[model samples]
Target: MRAFIGMDFDKGLKDELNGIQKVLKINSKKGNWVPSSNFHITLKFLGDISEEQVDAIDRIIKSAVVNTSPLSITLDKLGYFNIRSNQYGVIWIGIKGEMMKLNAIYGIIEKEMKVIGFPKEKRKLTPHITLGRRVILDLPFSQLREQVDHELGKEFLLDNLTLMKSEEIMRKRVYTPIKSYKFNKILEKNHR
Candidate 1:
């Protein structure tokens, strides 16, 4: 099955990103825009794994997230990623605010999943919500980069992590949540 671990967005946050996508579409002439309902921030892309491996993955995820607290992530900043040889494959909104906490969660999942034979993440965890994917690679990115308005400044509480199944419907990719794991959010405020 095609699978991954990710978090869904709240309605208000989704609306904010939807607004961002609308703007991005207006500026760029070449890209496949992501559907509003498909908006999510992936924690790990597991690719294709067997059902048995998924069960094991679930165990690892549950253990890793135990005692983890909810975090507030603010989505701000617009950026594009280079896929290969000057091809900017994806445009995303960068995440900030409470990133250390979010990184802690990502690290726990990454480390524990590795123990169960999943390959370790090669790159540093860059938390962002994908907005659009490039269809044509020949366009000058610098011009398009300047055209996009990237500051989104939307914040929301993230309380659950989900293991998702990806499937294509009507030529568009759709994500279905297989299982949802709630963060046992610690309520203590740190005294500094």
Candidate 2:
């Protein structure tokens, strides 16, 4: 089965993101825009893993997340990945807030996952959710960035990390969380 690890968005965040996507779609009119149901923050992309691998991954995640308290991430800015010369596609919204905590969890997952065969990421995590692929618009992506560059409606509370299953239905990819591992460890209260 195809599987990976990621975090889901709340309804309000999803709605807000959908509205942003709506405007981008209307403006660009050319791109593989992600469906709202498919919106998520990918922590790790495990292309295809066996059942045994899935079990191992679940164990790794559960063990690692137990030490982690809930984290908050904000929607910071609009950005994109360069697809070709002068064409920067793969539009996305960047992350902010409680980033150190997020990075710590990512590091733990990377270290454990690598022991089982997953390759370590060459580049550091950018921490963004892709909104569109192969995007084409009259103006440059830099120009578009200026237009949609706004702070988040609210911060995201990540109480859990998920092991997700990826499936193709009617020629479209659908992501569903098979298991969720919550971070229930208590943090020391800060005293003034």
Candidate 3:
């Protein structure tokens, strides 16, 4: 199956992201915009794996998240990664807040997955939510960025880590959660 590990956004966060997309749409001439329903923060992208591997992944998630509390993060910056050239690329909203905790959990998952035969990720993780792909702006990026509401500034708890399946249905990308692992509930309650 085509699968990955990710965190689903809460409704409030999704709405905020949607607002950002709307701004981008007004400034950009063309791009494949990500629907708000499809908005998520991908922790790891496991392109394809078998059922047995999925089971191993489950164990990895369970062990990696043990005693882990709900993670808090915020939408802090707007940026893009040049895909083909510097002018056109993937636009994203960068994440910040409680990053040290988030990185620790990500490191555990990366290491454990490698032990199970998955190749280690060479690049350091940059936590961000993709807003669009193959995007070309109508104006200079700095001008377009000024039009976006980049600093969402609201902090939200990431309560669960989900194993997601990706499929193209009716020519649209769809992400379905095969399973979700909730973080430490008692620790979560203590924080609030």
Q: Which candidate is the best by lDDT?
A: 3
lDDT: the better of candidates 2 and 3 = 3
Please give each candidate's TM-score: 0.84, 0.88, 0.91
Model 1: per-residue lDDT, tens digit, 1-192?
899998877677788888877766766556788898989989999988888897888887787568777788877677778767554599888878898888888898898888888888999998988988873434465665554444455568877788999999898899998877777634322211
Worst 10 residues of 2 by lDDT: 183-192
- Once all C-alphas are superposed, what RMSD does model 1 give against the true structure? 4.8
All candidates in order of TM-score, best leading:
3, 2, 1
Ordered list by lDDT, greatest first: 3, 2, 1
Task: Give one digit per residue, the lDDT tens place, for model 2 in 1-192.
Answer: 898888877677777788788767877847888999888888899998887787889889898777788888778888788877544478888889999988999999899999999999888988888888888776776767666766353687767789999999998989988888677744223210
| Candidate number of the best TM-score | 3
Q: Is candidate 1 or candidate 3 better by lDDT?
A: 3
State the displacement of the C-alpha of residue 42, model 1, in Å, after optimal TM-score superposition. 1.3
- Shift in Å, residue 105, candidate 1: 0.9
Report the number of clashing residue pairs per model. 0, 0, 0
- Answer with 2 or 3, whichever has the higher TM-score: 3
Per residue, candidate 3 scores C-alpha lDDT tens digits across 31-136 of: 9999898899888899988988888899888886777888889888888888565446789998899899889888988888889888878899999999998887
Native-structure RMSD, model 2? 4.3
What TM-score, to 2 decimals, does candidate 2 have? 0.88
